[model samples]
Target: MLDLNYILSSDYYKKELERIDRDNSVEQGLYFIIQSLLRSTIEEKYWVTDISTRSKKHIGFSKSVPDLTILEDGKTLFNPIAVAEIKYFPWSKKEYLTNNERQVKSYLKQVDKVIYTNGIEWIFLYGKGGSLERKESICLGNDRNTPESYYECINKKKLLSQIHWKNESDFKVSWDDLICKLGAFLK
Candidate 1:
């Protein structure tokens, strides 16, 4: 579990978002956030980033680098617990969408939870009932009027716990809970 408050309230995250906006690249923004989450230490547990694996596709190739992969001992069976694909879109795009079911299933073949985001909207897909289920359209921010505004996935209770925006107050609550959940699943 990640400390939502710590991430949301951090000056580093804010400054990074501003930099991404100035560069007009939502992919960069998403990368920064994921890196921060991976760097975040919770109860002595730190997330590992970009744990690479060879895709089963036998193209006679060595290994390939995917965007991001997070591993934990719990529920991952010695594999990555989460894989994410981050995209970027301008404001002119009215709809943000993804094939979470397909994407998650493909990753789940090698990992657990699968998430896709385009800086504005995010879709999380995870295994349930022997199939993938989706939680969609989580809005990170409403400042879509600006072409350079930051958008992210709001912390949802199903994903973690109640998250306070832009405040350090109680960030540990969500982080602790998420670690526990991951531990239980791993066990």
Candidate 2:
């Protein structure tokens, strides 16, 4: 389990999101946030990352680089297991879903399993053709559990028609039993 309040309340953790990004990308902020969280919580899996495999495709050849990869424990298994794709906070749900589906489909060619996330929305993908789909959806900011982060993104239509906006925070995550969830996932 992780200390959500302790970790999230820190200036260091908060600073990661405050930094400026190249080309004004919203996704850049989350790269830092996810990196910070992984560093603080799951160092064993992600820290000292296997940089050699960061963007390198599998043996045969592939065109995409997964946002993150958890190598298959070759000691126990002969092939790699999980690869992940990430989205940004500013993107609409539709954008994240469609883009991640495409990304996971591409990654599936090289690995057996794929994970999709937006730092908060974690969806596990598996199976083939007809069976290819999302499963094990984990929302770090669950609607009832963590409403502060259950945002639907900004409504551009309403912004033009009326000056109204939803009051939601960006990329905020808390322990909220995620320690148990992550423990199950990591295993």
Candidate 2's residue-wise lDDT over 89-134, tens digit each? 4445556656656555666765656666565455667655324654
Question: lDDT for model 2, on a 0 to 1 scale?
Answer: 0.45
Ten contiguous residues minimizing lDDT sum, candidate 2: 155-164
lDDT of each: 0.45, 0.45
Per-residue CA lDDT of model 1 for 1-187, tens digit only, reads 8545433344454455544544444455557665554445332343545433445342121223346656553523245556666665333335433333344455655544655654434455566432665443344433332332444322111222122232343434433443344334322
Q: Where does candidate 1 have its weakest 10-residue lDDT segment?
A: 154-163
Candidate 2 regions with alpha-carbon error over 4 angstroms? 1-25, 39-61, 72-79, 128-134, 140-174
After best superposition, candidate 2 residue 157: deviation in angstroms? Answer: 21
The C-alpha RMSD of each candidate to the native structure, in angstroms, is 9.8, 8.8
